[model samples]
Target: MAEITLVEAVNQALAREMSDNKNVLVLGEDVGIDGGVFRATAGLLDKFGDERVLDTPLSETLIGGVSIGMAAQGLIPVAEIQFMGFACSTIDQILNHAARIRNRTRGRLTCPMVLRAPFGGGIRAPEHHSESTEALFAHIPGLRVVIPSSPERAYGLLLASIRNPDPVVFLEPKRIYRLVKQEVPDNGEALPLDVCFIIRPGNDVTIVTWGAMTHDSLVAADKLAEQGISAEVIDVATLKPLDIETISVSVEKTGRCVIVHEAPLSGGWGAEISARLAEHNLFNLLAPIKRVTGYDTVMPLFRLEDQYMPSTDRIVGAVNEVLKFE
Candidate 1:
């Protein structure tokens, strides 16, 4: 076991997968030679060689289409978009073709491809580099959207995504990419997809969050504990095919809930979680579900980025507001 950052864990997963499965190939802008914009694919080219680790032109549309073609032909391609913002150009290929291949072919074919991108704010990136619009992908019918908040989860979830027999949108939260380190075994074990990870348990309030926001949620939970408020924290690892049952169980016990995310307040994945809880677990609630999230506007530039993202105080405030109801 080795203690590594989230980005390093991602590299380890890619290397292990490429080693175990010869059909597993990696391609994207600078993924091979430059080792990805964040180096999540570092040292892969030397190990897998030019044939398997490819560096394509700066065209996300081409990368998405090529990955679909390769997957259809039996190659499990792991394509990278430099940033989530750049992924917008590939929406057509991902939604119209890659995501629909299995259904269109009536199980005659499957598209086993993983699209990876660094998302969210906190590193002072310029325009088109700090997007966290995961809701857009989660809304798509056939694609799975996965986000990991820690090194261990990043390793396991990425392995699961690559091995899955369907197209997956793997969003890497770059904000916490190097924020923490944890011991991760390189045994190539894949964590189960479509499940929420209960990071902490409490009886007062359930704080549901994902991606970089999970960090803030955990911090807020600790702050609440100091103030005599017990809070459970859950990381929604897989946004699409959500594990609402886990969330429902938590809410049933705590009788209060607060959903948080770095994405905009409107139409974010948090809304979906709130809706499911209201539909299936309304009677179990002790307070109205609250949301602590970014504004319903574009992610501000570096100077004002922190203001736009939800803070630990904001999460605690939301908890306080929900707690007041009961």
Candidate 2:
């Protein structure tokens, strides 16, 4: 095992995959010579040559559109959008083509493309750079969405997404890319795509979250332990086909929940989790399920961003509120 940053792990994964599979290719802005803005693909171009590591023009639509075409023709395309926010510009192509080609062509065509996007805030980036748009992509029918909180998971899941026979949106949490380091093997072994991991075991309250918020939940859970509260922290690694069973099982035991995220509260992914919890197992709710998330407003600039995102105090407060009924 080796301790590596998330960025380095991803860079390793790309290099390893390209070495093993000649058909695997990467394309995105500044990906060739300059590497990515985050340096996730820093040395890939030097190793694989321009054909496999391409630097496309500043056009996300073309990136998404051409990726679908390349994948349909049997080349495994690992396309990157500089930021998660930038990918929104190509929603038309993603939803209309990359997402629907398998069913649209009645199995004659398969678009096995991985759309990599660096997302989330806390680095004080410009507007739209920190937005968590997983909910929007989850709403799409055929696209698979995955987020990795640790360096190891990032490498493994990304490799899995590239090999899977469907379009996947892999959201790499930029905040923890280099800040959070973990011991990951050099080989990019893939993870099972349809399940969540229980990072911490507990029986009091379940904290459901992903991406950057996973770290927030971990911090909050640690603090809650001081107050004699056991909050089970479950990471929804695969956001699209959510591991509903694992989540429900934890809630079934804990009997209380606090769905958290960096995105705004109203239509955020937390809302969907809460709705499903309320509908399927009302009796298990010890208190009304709580949600600590961003406000229902545009992601503000760095100055006021703190007020827009969830915090440890808010999570602690929610857990305290649930405990009051006990």
The 10-residue segment with the lowest total lDDT in model 2: 186-195
The 0-to-1 C-alpha lDDT of every candidate, in the order given, reads 0.95, 0.90
lDDT of 1 by residue, 75-96 (tens): 9999999999999999999999
lDDT of 2 at 224: 97
Estimate, for each residue in 136-158, the C-alpha lDDT of model 2 and write its tens digit: 99889998999988888888888
TM-score of 1: 0.99
Q: Candidate 1: where is the Cα deviation over 4 Å?
A: none
> How well does each candidate superpose onto the true structure, as a TM-score?
0.99, 0.98
Q: Which parts of model 2 are misplaced by more than 4 Å?
A: none
